[model samples]
Target chain A: MRHPSYLLACLYLLSLSACTSVTIDEYQRAEASLASGDRIVLLGRRHSPDYETEPDLINCVGKVISANQSGISVIPEKQFVDELYPWFEPRMAPMRPERLEYLMKQPQVREKIEDLKLRYVIWIDGSTQQTGSAGSVGCAVGPGGGGCFGFGTWDDKSDYEAEVWDYQKQDLVAKVSADAKGTSYMPALVVPIPLLARVQSNACKGLGAQLREIFVPDSSANAGA
Target chain B: MKKQLSRSLLMLSSLILAACSSQLTVKGQFPSPLTTAMPLHGAAYYSPELISHSYAEDDEDRVKWNIQTGAAQQEFFDSLLPALFQQWAGHSPDPEGEAFKLPGVDIIVKPTLSDFQYSLPRETRSKIFEVWIKYNMQLYQNDGQLLADWFITAYGKTPSGFMQSDEAAMNEAIIVALRDLGANLTVNFSRVPELQDWMGKRDSSVQQQSADRGGVQNETP
Candidate 1:
């Protein structure tokens, strides 16, 4: 019965930690669809001075979308930026669909996009930040050995939004956003046991799944056909 | 045997201490800007010192750093100037010689690395390395009249990563700064007041010459 109390406490701690809630909201102005040969490029917005959207998050979403969806190709962000060169650099990239019209007017850029069969440009902006943190863990080492004893906990929030621009139509077709929040903990008696909440990855998967649903509504149906 | 062991320990300590210093050779890939080429022949002149520029700093804590960016700057302009003008030419003087004016060049551009500075993660109490570069750009006409003299400043920063070397982080920061320089120069070149005035006058003069030639042709019949 005494050991059962330890089990109950463990369950309580696990319940308090590692619980991530992800919410996704999508706005579509027009019908958005993707063809088999069409390509999509994911770019992170880096113009903000305070915080930059992490390249890792962009890559994670790209991987998730490509892994789950069929007949969809995702262009690597660096490749796309490098192929277009200075035009797509952080300061020079088009922030709005209207500015993209001017970019398309450039013959080389237009030709490259056409040659690559690029259909959509998804601009992901936002970052994950530590909203709050409390508690601390301490460890000691001596001639005999070393052990850690304490409890530490922190909260993180991630907010990201994706703006999908259609190349042919030269308009913003869809806007999707994801927000996630979670708390992580590390409890130590003799050894520290870490329970990390995957807030950024959860947000990435949520956003990726929503993007896939918009691009491919009936993936199974398409597959059977 | 004790003396030999002490010497070995001394050598190991020196090796560990030497690892704290960093030397970085910055390299970058510059892209041609996306703008219509102006109908002018521009000659770019880079001094030998600019081509071999390096910034070295020794801090109070005995940490030394040297960053070489001269070759990268030269390459950046070599790719940028040709795409900005209809005709492009490059001129470089020998180490001991002075750069002379080109015969048929419409405009000459001289750029110099004025200043370079950086900050380390430990100093800033943050997980990022930052670099700033300042350049002085001088534009002259074929007759040696100064058209525009301006300063362009660029900044770059990279977040420090776990298990990443200081040299790698600094190199990435330099590359970012170089890219930023390209973006600023390409987008803001035509907007310079002196350049705009000179270009407007040059275009009108060319139009006048064409009109005079047409009048002469009309009278010949």
Candidate 2:
């Protein structure tokens, strides 16, 4: 009976732990870039870039790219991979600057890049890793049946950064970053309850919002209050 | 009296655990690959006894069970493999191929369940209920020629805090296994020498048709 309260307290404390977010850095239109307006990178420029209507704009953009169909070129992940085959390797994604620079030199590559009509090459990259976990668990197994007993905690940190490369200028311009930490627990005294980290998803959304800000040009954020 | 009370408590716990056992099933196929229908013959054989019918828990090394869930190896294998095969290979013209004798059956797959278990392993201060399955696949030509025979093992693990139940873990593991199985068949189907020869012998136009289809695979054998 007392154990449940103790576990709840632990969970409460864990949830209270601080969460980090992405910082949308300063960026400018590359000299070679096309002039465009607010549109989510996920949904291409078919719909109008109406930011007020989509309050959940931050949630819409998964990593860095705005998913609005109107402003950003929303190339399907499959199509992007297939069309840019030999170049757009999904396994080896977030192509290195040097590699991208080399590819931009090729006429055919440049033609394809222009063909995609990508104004800003948004590279959203990051991963969540379990940094540390500590605790002990023991289970009792017998003919009657088996159950686990023990308490443990796992530490996980999600670190992600988004980089926007201007293909026209052939230069890296904007960078946004987010980092958050979380903990998971196993309180399997009689019954088990697991509290996994809320790190990666938070980092993704946090970073995504900042990237959207840069693309959407938030007047509220820019205006001096 | 204490012993009696403990027994009663154990019985009550067993009932509750049984109720908590999940009913998991794989629904729908991924997507059909082949344009044409190929008759796949034979049933995937899973010994229910080999894998305990109820939920079993392996604590790192020790294995024990107390709850009996509705999940069965045969039910899972029967429902999943056909649809999986369709997605990976193409189409199974005859999903229900009859016995040892069937007409127009070019390829037959005999799948035997080797090892199936859900375990909770302690790693880096976390308990992961790892569901794993090992199965042997025997690919044979219609003329009873063994084209290829191999074993595949696949697993799915969820941390102690995230996993629903052993049955759920088992279901995920099954899906992973079948996914692997489908990929195995698709990539290796054309590589079977016996199948190639049999198809060529049955119809001389088979090679010509394949050539016309421009079917070139990376792993030809």
Candidate 3:
């Protein structure tokens, strides 16, 4: 027979483990065929009238992809931004479907991508936000010092999407989306120590791996080596 | 030996009790009616101003419709509404994750819960005991333009004792409101004059097409 204490310990660990996830939802997929000469860039700086750019997440995923160094040439986010700055500002901003179509039809834009051999421009967008929380974690503020106690859990979730535009072909070839929600605990022990979920990490890993899988086709060859 | 045994027993008890801690989550009503009705596309958000006031009204009975934690309240709306809108608008790569933030699409929606009230059930089949949700929503372009603004109220009419026990009716009321909001947006969006103005600026072809069609559709349900 199993010991009750052992079972209890297992249960405690299981609850903690449940607070992280990696979910990959591919909206559209690309051909697994190798594009050896094709260069791809993940556009990290999202063109938004509102909301700050997710530089950390952009860099994290970029680093992950560059580390893989697979078939698709990862052009690096910094280089991609710097190379296309000043120009392509109005062209890349998110707009209506018809407007984007018109943009892709532009002679100057098409020529630029063709000249650069920039086969794919993956527009990446995502953010981490708290979803739901339960219980109560309160605190006090004073001169000597502030202390917080009580137990509460906030649901932190990371959502990411990549729109792969075949700039040369002037078409949106693939779209990859990953969103994960995890609960974070704020246990008040004189101060609120937040056990944040690795939402961004999970999303980054999920998206990076999926992008590689779709574009690179073979991942094991690059694994560990 | 006795003290060690007692400590182990206490540890075991604590672990068992930990599972019983209040596990709160925000849920959404599914299969929005607008999905099939309107084959359109759009984005959604929850403004920080609206999210800043994330509290539900308290009950004298202290029973239903009481969202004690502000974070949980915000999360519930953030996760649920945008996902619903994504499907309703036929948005590929849905806007659930980017709720209340700029979605960078043609049509932008902001859903704010202005107020709500939950009344406990008195009888088994009485409409008197109901939950109400007052929702304020807006649709606009990314370029700081407002298209449509709608203020809607939804009712959750439950005649059951179980439904009213823990503010279940109130949550249901919210779903009702969201469904109505989706349907309204789908039917009424094309009627927004600003959308035509937007189309004129973004794509001249669309404006030409509008002129060729005589005019943009003026019908609204």
Candidate 4:
């Protein structure tokens, strides 16, 4: 009974609204996989002179440990016996396939590790580049008592990027790379606040979740015991 | 009446735009750099020469002990040693607000200026500050027997125009290196096992609490 023009307008509105509903497939998969018992290990390394590997690895592992609620046991890959036991020797042994298999077959090792619901190994390698763009704008305000004066303000924008990788089945399963941008406005009368770092932090956290999903498929097959 | 309404609408729009355009600012004052002071000792020693290989030269350059003393070199040490000490002091877990006591019986900062070279390849490489600060610190007795001997290097690069800033840069580099060294020293002093055990217990408790609350049992102790 509605007019044709109204119907067309309604349809247009619906179509426009559809564009805003982002189907975040990555987040959904990560959440689903995490709900099921799946063990994941994070092996983080940095190939840059500026970065320290241990702290970043610890942070990434902390994120993984915090995200999942299942019986998932997130371990640092370096802590595995095959990696640590070599320290006792005069020289470290090379990571041979036979040695790996033997280590995997050990009863104590198998018993403690077999109960792991799922195993996910993630590697993060990236650098942080900080760049900013600034601009100024002027505004006029009428006097509250009589007339208004004018004020100038400055604004800035910052961007960040992260490079990540996931290894599964002893192969490179997936790779995730992301960038985030944010802006900060400083009034002429006030001090400037650094807002870009906050935006970048949020982006990195979101990327972490996305990386989890890409590396771990949301299927019973990948579920931990 | 229509004209008045239009004027009011325009004013409302202007108000909205003004409100949207304005920026929020915060003001705070940081502590003055000078208010905080670092403890100083009378004299520090250095090894004879720095040992480094130059990319341009085939041979390794090693300066002997007696050749490494001067006003310029002293200036370099003045900047470097304090920076290192400050870095250690910042992260030292000796409880905040207490005087910084050297962990060992005697604190000795033994600096070595190795690979000190000034060359001109493209432009004039007037002054290149490359040196290593090796702390041969002993906890007990002043006889140079060290409880901990931390070897750290501070590298500095200066352009012709910025040659004067070399001392400051060297100082900053030494501070960073010493901060790292101090962290290592603290870790070694505390012994990683005790810290690991504490961290493990904390992790276990956290996991247990999470399990009890039925929140998320994803973490393993």
C-alpha RMSD for every candidate? 4.9, 12.7, 18.8, 22.1
- Among the numbered candidates, top lDDT falls to 1
DockQ of 3: 0.01
**Taking chain A by itself, what TM-score does each prediction score?**
0.89, 0.63, 0.70, 0.44
Segments in model 2 whose C-alpha atoms lie over 4 Å from true places: A1-156, A161-177, A181-202, A210-225, B1-100, B117-129, B143-145, B155-170, B200-221
How well is each residue in B52-148 modelled by candidate 1, as lDDT tens digits? Answer: 9998886667468988889998998898877778888776332123454556778788889999998888988666788899999988877666789
Model 4 per-residue lDDT at B30:
14
In terms of lDDT, model 4 sits at 0.37
Q: Which ten residues in a row have the lowest lDDT in candidate 4 chain A?
A: A17-26
lDDT of 4 by residue, B1-221 (tens): 99999999999998875553312111111111111122322235433332221112223242111222233344444433443233332212221124534453233444443333322212232222232334333221134333333343323232222233433433333333333333333224334353345446757998998777774444435
| Per-residue lDDT of B158 in model 1 | 78
Per-residue alpha-carbon lDDT of model 2 for A45-139, expressed as tens digits? 10111111111222345434434332444555434443443344322233554566766664555666567776566565544567888987788
Pairs with backbone N, CA or C atoms under 3 Å apart (clashes), candidate 3: A131-B75, A133-B72, B45-B100, B46-B100
- Candidate 1 lDDT over A7-65, as tens digits, reads 78767766663889999999998788887689999999977655678888989988877
Predicted structure with the largest DockQ when compared to the true one: 1
Chain B vs. true chain B: TM-score for each candidate? 0.86, 0.51, 0.51, 0.29
Comparing to the true complex, what docking class would candidate 2 get? incorrect
